[model samples]
Target: MPSVQIKICGLTTREALDAAIAARADYCGFVFYPPSPRTLTPVAARDLADRAGARIGKVGLFVDPDDALLAQGVEAGSLDAIQLHGRETPARAAEVRARFGLPVWKAIPVTAAADIERAAEYREAADLILFDARTPKGALPGGMGLKFDWSLLAGYDSPIPWGLAGGLTPHNVCEAIRATRAPLVDTSSGVESAPGEKDIGKIAAFCAAVRSA
Candidate 1:
């Protein structure tokens, strides 16, 4: 299996953070959206980031947040990247990048082939585009453990750096990677004991699965 970058998202505990570090995940994601089960405040996220101590990429996940919230998260968490998981327009993404001088990653929900094409409009605005499974309306933005058709990404072309998310578990990540040829993969509920509760063993196993793929 070729090397695949891994991101453990929705981490809210130091134990889980340590597991990600030990497992050599490329990114550590902290949700800033209040409604998420794994959401963290800037202050708490700051402490976790400090504990991570440059061992991993610290990503601050937001949902159509304002400038003030973005500033606060960056200041407190020392974020390495900003993930826009809401219905943020391309112009807004560019604006945030200009204002914060941090790498911007846009989360695009995919239920149809056309949704994947949406990344074209964000080429200049975001450094990364994460394609995730589309959830039912009124559900949480992500971490619902839903997955899109991997065949949709077979030989897929992306305008920017990209990753796969949603419904990825240790059992299927290898198939997902092989099918999509995704260079990076992100998981939250996939390695969790419950919503917002990460399982260290699963975390380690998932990373190993990616490596073995």
Candidate 2:
């Protein structure tokens, strides 16, 4: 199998961003949602985006964003893709993709086998389908360090490109890849020492684990 692609998300500081780059992460994610501690201002995202300079993919994560918010994030972050983590429908995702002229990644919250079928709904609407653990109602959508059964995805046919997230860390990412053969893997809280504080050593360790997986 090919090396698992890694995405280190929820980056808010230059030191963290630099650590992700040095770790050879395939993508660096910036949160645009205000509720998350990792959220970044457009101005802040611009500085980090400039520093990134195409060395790695820059993804902007939003939750039910308006067009103005999307525009701000795209331009500010020089984003290569937009990740919609809200309760957006397929039509809405398509609209966001058309308006931004960038690839759209729709996050699917999974709890059971039936939830995996939901990816079919975004077949034409999204470039990728992110299967993250389902958080409880009234809680944050993701990045909560929760995990579902990996066997749920084993050998399941998917209509679009998919990845694994939720509760993944350096210790378990290798097993995740082996179990799901996830083309990509994402981490936010898992690599952080706190809710939003990304640890440099953890970042490197996670990436190394993925590469070796």
Candidate 3:
């Protein structure tokens, strides 16, 4: 099997960014949602993305942002990909890709078998699909720090590239990967000291687990 790719999300500080880079994370995600504790301003995100350089891909995480906000992120000049973590439709995903000229990663929340089945509808619209744990009925969109049953993804196949996210920590990331054989894994709260605070040690440990897996 190919090596699993690791993406450390919700990075807000230079220290955290440095830690992710040192750990050789395949992707570093910046939250653009204002409600998220990990949220960053376009300027702040640009700085971190610039510091990230080309060693690792910089991902802009958005939740139903408007065209103006999305354009600001693209103009920031550090994002290599855009991750839609909201209820955007396939047409919206296609529009975002065309407008920004960047690879788009559509996040699909999976809590039941049917959720995985819906991924097929986005195969042609998104460049990649991220399977995340579904939020509670009245909760926020992504980064809920909850996990769905890994068994739901067993033997899963799709034409578009895909990834796994939600509640992934160093302790269980390997098991998650082992069970689903996900090519890419995304983490937010799992590597944080607090809701929005990223722990460098945890970042390194998480990456180590991915590499070992």
RMSD of each: 0.9, 0.7, 0.9
Q: What is the C-alpha lDDT profile of model 3 across 1-213, one tens digit per residue?
A: 998888999999999999999999999998888888999998898888778789889899999989998888776737899999999999999999998889999999988999998888887789999999999876878777899999999999977899999899999999999999999999999999899999999999999999999
Q: By the lDDT metric, which is better: model 1 or model 3?
A: 1
lDDT of all the models against the reference?
Answer: 0.94, 0.95, 0.91
Q: List the residue pairs that clash in candidate 3.
A: none
Give candidate 2's root-mean-square deviation (CA, Å).
0.7
List TM-scores for all candidates, in order.
0.98, 0.99, 0.97
Tell me the spans in candidate 2 whose CA falls farther than 4 Å from its real position.
none
Better of 2 and 3 by TM-score: 2
- What tens-digit string does per-residue lDDT give for candidate 2 at 1-213? 877788999999999999999999999999999999999998899999999998899999999999999999999999999999999999999999999899999999999999999999999999999999999999999999999999999997888888999999999999999999999999999999999999999999999999989
lDDT of 1 at 148: 93
Which residue pairs collide in model 1, if any? none
Which candidate number would show the highest TM-score if scored against the true structure?
2
Top-down lDDT ranking: 2, 1, 3
- Measured with C-alpha atoms, the lDDT of residue 92 in candidate 3 is 95
How well is each residue in 12-103 modelled by candidate 1, as lDDT tens digits?
Answer: 99999999999999999989989999999877998998999889999999999999999998888889999999999999999999999999
